[model samples]
Target: MSKPIIATTSLAGCFGCHMAILDIDARILQLIDLVEFNKSPIDDIKTFTKECDIGIIEGGCCNSENIHVLKEFRKHCKILISLGECAIMGGLPALRNGIPVKECLEEAYLNGPTVGRNTERILPNDEELPMILDKVYPCHEIVKIDYYLPGCPPKADLIWAAVVALVTGDELNIPYELVKFD
Candidate 1:
């Protein structure tokens, strides 16, 4: 039988979740034996070449490009798993939820301490730029997420367990120690 195909992407948050996948370490050899990857940053595939069995998403939607990629994942994958706190609840990026987008932009480009001397004070307005959303949104808020692994970056064992269970049709057995969000 052909191995299940998996795909993954990072949207708005740090790539910590992808790092956690690598943290699976030596067991990644086992993972390779169990499944094949498609349209993933791990393989540097920019677009889906075929349908995938599972799609693991690592971050939340913070801009138009993120939404587009997520919607494409939903269309191409049979099961979609939100792989970290960022994918499940918008994580640190959602801290801007309470602030107005204009204020955020001004602070980032025109007034904040990091801003360089901008005599013209130009905000990025190139049509090529992906339009930023007013607030970061969890994956579930935008797409029909089939499962979620919640943590700043979910434990490597937890990720392993979930992937194995889905691939083998076994019930997920997460250890108590792996349940901590931190």
Candidate 2:
């Protein structure tokens, strides 16, 4: 029998989720034996070449491009998972919800102490830059997410459990210690 195909992406996040995936240690070998990866940073695959059985997304949407990619992920995968607190509720990025985009930009680019020596005071108006949304949006708010793994970076075992359950048709048992918020 062929292995299930998995795809993953990180958006508007710290990339800690991906690191956690690696934290499963040697068990990753077991994962490799169970499934294949596509369009994920792990494989350096930039585009979807085939339909995927599962898609794991980390982080929330904070710009037009993130939304676009997320929608595409939903269309291409049979089971889409919101793999972190960011994907579940916009996480730390959602802290910007109450703050206006204009103010955020000024704080990040023009006025913040760390932005020093910005005599030009430009706020990245290039055409290549994506348009920032007024507020970060959780993945479920934008598309139909089939599952959610709530964590700042979701413990490695939690991720492993979720993936194994889906691929092997087993019920998932999330340990109490692994289910955390903050």
Candidate 3:
């Protein structure tokens, strides 16, 4: 029998989640031997192919690229795991939900004291930048999320539990160390 294919992808996030996965260290080595890593930065992956056994997506939908990735992940992975607080509830970036997108962009780029202040030159309607969603939402809102493990970057043990469950087809006993945050 062939080993299950496991793929990991990132969206609008700091990539801290990806780094955290590596924090699993030696356990990941075991995982590498057990499953094929179809998509992950560590493997120089850039896209998702069809029919992945387990897909781990870290980050939230914040742009067109993110949306495209999410939809593709939904279409491809049999079991999708939302890896962190960002994918579960849009983290720090979602804090801007109450503010206008234009104002937020200004605070980031235009209105900064160090940046040039030229409203006439400022273009809020850039074609490349996706319009911000009216409110932050978890992955399930856009597409069905089979499982979720929440944390700023979820406790590594939780990630390991989820991976084991997916690979072994068993219910994971949520360890106290893993669910303490909830």
By lDDT, the best candidate is 1
RMSD of 2: 1.1
Candidate 1, residue 8: Cα displacement in angstroms equals: 0.3
After superposing candidate 3, which stretches have Cα over 4 Å from the reference?
116-120, 124-131, 180-182
How many residue pairs clash in all the candidates, one count each?
A: 0, 0, 0
In order, the Cα lDDT scores of the candidates are: 0.94, 0.92, 0.79
Give a tens-digit lDDT track for model 1, residues 55-162: 999999999999999999999999999999889989899999989999999999999998998889899999999999999999999999999898888998899999
lDDT, candidate 3, 42-117, per-residue tens: 7987776547988888888877678888888888889889988888888777887788777777787776777676
Instruction: Report the lDDT tens digits of candidate 2 across residue range 1-182.
Output: 88899999998888999999999999988999999999999999999998999999999999999999999899999999998899999998899899999999999999888888889889889999999999999999999999998887899988999899999899988879997875
Q: Which residue pairs in candidate 2 collide? A: none
Per-prediction TM-score, please? 0.98, 0.96, 0.88
Off by more than 4 A, model 2 = none
**Model 1 CA lDDT for position 93:** 94
